[model samples]
Target: MTKPKTQEPVITSTSELPTSEAKWVTLRKVNYTDQTGAARTWEVASRKTRAKSAGVDAVAMGNVILHPARAPATVVVIQYRPPLDAYTVEWPAGLIDEGESAEDAAVREFKEEIGYDCEVTSVSPVQAADPGMSDANMKLVMVEVKLGEEDGEELPVQRLEDGEHIQRVVVPLTELYQRLVEWSEGERKIVAAKLFHFAAGMEFARKEGKKYGL
Candidate 1:
């Protein structure tokens, strides 16, 4: 069967709205007294879908793909971000369902986005997604996926939703940071901050290890 070509999403127009009219995310003015005793009001955006059971708005998967003879790799997804009106390279992520846990959300999102089942290895504490701009928070869930020799070169089919046109890129662990940087420059793509920070941290640790002979 021939698959239908995906169309690139474009913003036809943009407009401003009062906070009260927002559905998915709402803006708020936080009033508080500063350390110096001056009153302050800060504007912030908050997600209306934050699940109390999940204790977070979202979960991003830090997936490590293990192969018998190849270097370990990770999956990064590229998709159009409407707010930015640009394609973004980001960790496979999704909102946590009302009744789901972080680990479950990680596994489900990884499968839906990357087409690989993963084992949740660790879950980071809830972290701010954009502290200065929004009150949205997410947890980084580290997961591992093992691939058989036959599956090494084949890309699995993604189980994405109708409007989700995601392209998955498998990147070797050692080359991730450089690869992301190259993608950002060469393709003029937006890289998600959390994903960039993760790659940068790994690269930093690797360089430090070599420097100290660890």
Candidate 2:
């Protein structure tokens, strides 16, 4: 008699996986059938805030702040990211509060992280942070601010949260791309995608004499 072969289990749906307790984040495992209908399993890391939301998860916001001065400049922040165990250079960003819009969240984060009260000039469509791994989304807001002697006001002070430690870095508009390139080659440094995209648009606009949506 010939020996019989065992059939593999087919996964038709996803479910949450058991994980250790964490305050800000959680992990889940999903099971599904791929395009070829093969059973597959994947793990996802999600923000606890989104998981705990009553209805739909709130979108996050980031600001691309431009300071109009004798020499045009843009603002970014350097802060420690626990996951990477390194400092990340990113735009001012935060999650939208329950009753706030993306523009409102952008303004609040700008004040909290960079200490600047800026006028929001434009807001971009929502973009996924990482579709393959996370469901996080954020809108990039363009803010025009007058800094230094241009606005006739003193330097703004950061209003960071209790556990936050952020440092402001200003890059000259002309050198924004160059600085990004340098940072890309540096050690233990990660640049936010939104910042890179915004800077690239600005650079393109400068070369082509076309406005890239501010």
Please report the candidate that would top TM-score against the real structure.
1
For model 2, how does the per-residue alpha-carbon lDDT over 1-214 read when each residue is reduced to its tens digit? 6834533223456555556756776888889999999999998877767523322233323434444445666777877776565667877777777766767777788878778787888877767778799767666677777555456334478887876877678767789877987887887778877678867877787876654443
Best by lDDT: 1
Tens-place lDDT digits, model 1, residues 34-98: 99999999999899998888789999998899999899999899888998888899999999999
Worst 10 residues of 2 by lDDT: 51-60
RMSD of 2: 14.5
Estimated TM-score per prediction?
0.93, 0.72
In model 2, the runs with Cα more than 4 Å from the true position are 1-18, 33-39, 51-69, 147-154, 204-214
TM-score of 2: 0.72
lDDT of 2 at 125: 77
Each candidate: how many clashes?
0, 0
Global lDDT of model 2: 0.69
